[model samples]
Target: MISLLLVDDHPVVRDGLRGMYSADPRFEVVGEASNGAEGIAMAVALRPDVIIMDLRMPGSDGVSAIRALAERGIPSRILVLTTYDTDSDVVAAIEAGATGYLLKDSPREELFRATEAAAQGETALAPTVAARLLGRMRRPSGGGLSQREVEVLELIARGSTNREAARRLFISEATVKTHLLHAYTKLGVNDRAAAVATAFSRGYLSHDNNDE
Candidate 1:
């Protein structure tokens, strides 16, 4: 049987999870905690196979606890079970060494499977969370900026019009526009001026590059 720990701030939620796993023959609900800090202490004491963690709580949020568990070299795999699936929350949990990310609305069978997978040290992600992670992976790696994006922004920052940049770079004006659009998305800006400014502030473009 897979030993499990349910860590959430809500008593009802914890009761529900404990009852669910308690009914399963393949699992054992070893313990429960109301917050991350308590969860960490129990996790150290019980050393369960899987920890189902909730991201937000009144004290010591899940991400911080996950980081702490990792820093202390805890061997149990963590599975985030939370209501929040925003990009920041998902990324932070995964980056902090969570083995799985599942939303609170996940079906019971899905949660069971995820818990099992996490026990075996496998990745289990909800569909939306998986798509978000895939999108992030496909984006440009460093600061989400590509070489072409930097070139386009550099030219625009140096007072080159789209047509002029196209002529100088031997690409079509349409291509210049495309590059600028990509840069704007990566830089989180709406226009050429804002993109250039954001890129320069982020070191994706430099004064020396503008001079060139």
Candidate 2:
């Protein structure tokens, strides 16, 4: 059985996940946490093979908590289970070392398979999310921003808020949100920080000044 930990703020959600894993003979829900901090603690103490993580939390939040774990070089793999969003948290989580992203509403079977895949060092994302991102990449615009919805992504990497990114890009916030969603899908990351990090690691964000 693949040992796993479930982390989410809602007791109901955690309970549901626990129940789901209980039915899957290949998985064992070894521990649980209601927030990122407790999740980190449980992760350190139990050393689960994979962590099913919600991207938001009260105290430590998902991304920072993941980063803390990574900084400590813990070997546990992280699988993000969150609603679709393109922002700092998702980006930061991926940058911090999460292995995969899955929508919280993904069918329980997919979640289970994803957890199993993660244990073997594989990655997965929701299909619609992946398609949307790929469509943007096939766009005909020549500027890096052309084919890829990059202008807002640049702001994302610089730690800009959605409103700030919209204003800087001369687009409506809703439009910016749309672009962010697409970028998140394409980058195969759940949040802006992770998307940016993936881009950087993949050499998409090439810049001479590393200070920014």
Candidate 3:
């Protein structure tokens, strides 16, 4: 059986996941954490094969915990299980070393398969999430921003400095700058403000939220 740790802020979600996994003969629900902080602690203590993490939480978020686990060289494969599927959310989680990304609404059988795949250190993305990644890969030359570039631009639009964006994205400040430069080139802008403005104008970013 694949050992699993369920990490979600909602007790109901956690309980439901626990019940589902508990009924499965191929899996074992080794632990459940109400938030990312406790999830990381339990992960360290239990050393489960797979960790099903939620993105947003009360204290530390899932991405932060994922980065912490990677930094500490934890062997558990992180499989994000959340209701969010925004570009920023998906890109950030994957970039932070999550082994897979699945929506909370995924079918039970799909979740089971994804958990098994994650335990084996394989990528398992929800269809919408996979389509987004694939679209980023297939973006034409100079047509649009790459996912990383978009992420950088979104952070900049939110008033994040290079250092802050780098920290949030788990990349170097220099790398963040490079992404900004690439975004500028793609958007045909000469500076940060222009890049953000143009991206918004071109619908690359939403007026309400860059991630949308």
Candidate 4:
């Protein structure tokens, strides 16, 4: 069973989460906290496999708590659970060492899956959150992105699959991936969809272009 630590400011929220976990045979709510500071203490003491964190709290916000636990070399993976899904919240939680970021309204099964993924030290992000993060990254400066990277991103933005992109570009699929990866680095994104979105948003790729 996956061991869990829930940390939220509201008693009712904690109660609801505890009940959800209690009903699942695959998980157990090992501890609960009302704020980030308490959550950090309990997480370190209990050493649960995963900690369900909240971003906004009365004291020691979730981002700070996540950073503190990471600095102290705690092994518990933190999975953020809250109502906020803004770009700032998602990015801060992730940069502070959160394993996953899921909104509170997520389906019960998704929450369970996110907790499981977090326990295993995997990165999990809500679909909308992921999109926002990818699309919201800052653009590179001084011609940081390569011409090939722009080409690949443009094709991707135009609804081309990797194979199709490769065929159109007359490059190998591996080459396409390499360009995409480079574009991701330059665009500060993690995936192809995000790269394309960022590219368009940053004017690296335009909709009225014909560069195939």
lDDT of 4: 0.87
Give the number of the best model, judged by TM-score.
1
Candidate 3 error regions (>4 Å): 140-212
TM-score of each: 0.70, 0.64, 0.69, 0.67
lDDT of 4 at 38: 96
Instruction: Report the error of model 1 at residue 182, Å.
Output: 8.0
User: How does residue 23 of candidate 3 score in lDDT?
Assistant: 96
Residue-wise C-alpha lDDT for candidate 2, range 1-212, written one tens digit per residue: 99999999999999999998988899899999999999999999999999998987888788877888898888899998888545344456667888888888799789878888889988776664454445445543542333336667767777789899888878899998888787777666798778777766544553432346
Name the regions of candidate 4 deviating beyond 4 angstroms.
141-212
Off by over 4 Å in 1: 143-212
1 versus 4: better TM-score goes to? 1
- The order by descending TM-score is 1, 3, 4, 2
Candidate 4 residue-wise lDDT, 66-141, digit = tens: 9999999999999999899876798889989999999999999898888989888899899878767765554555
Task: Tell me each candidate's RMSD, in Å, in order.
Answer: 11.0, 11.6, 9.1, 11.5
Report how far off residue 85 is in candidate 2 (Å).
Answer: 3.1
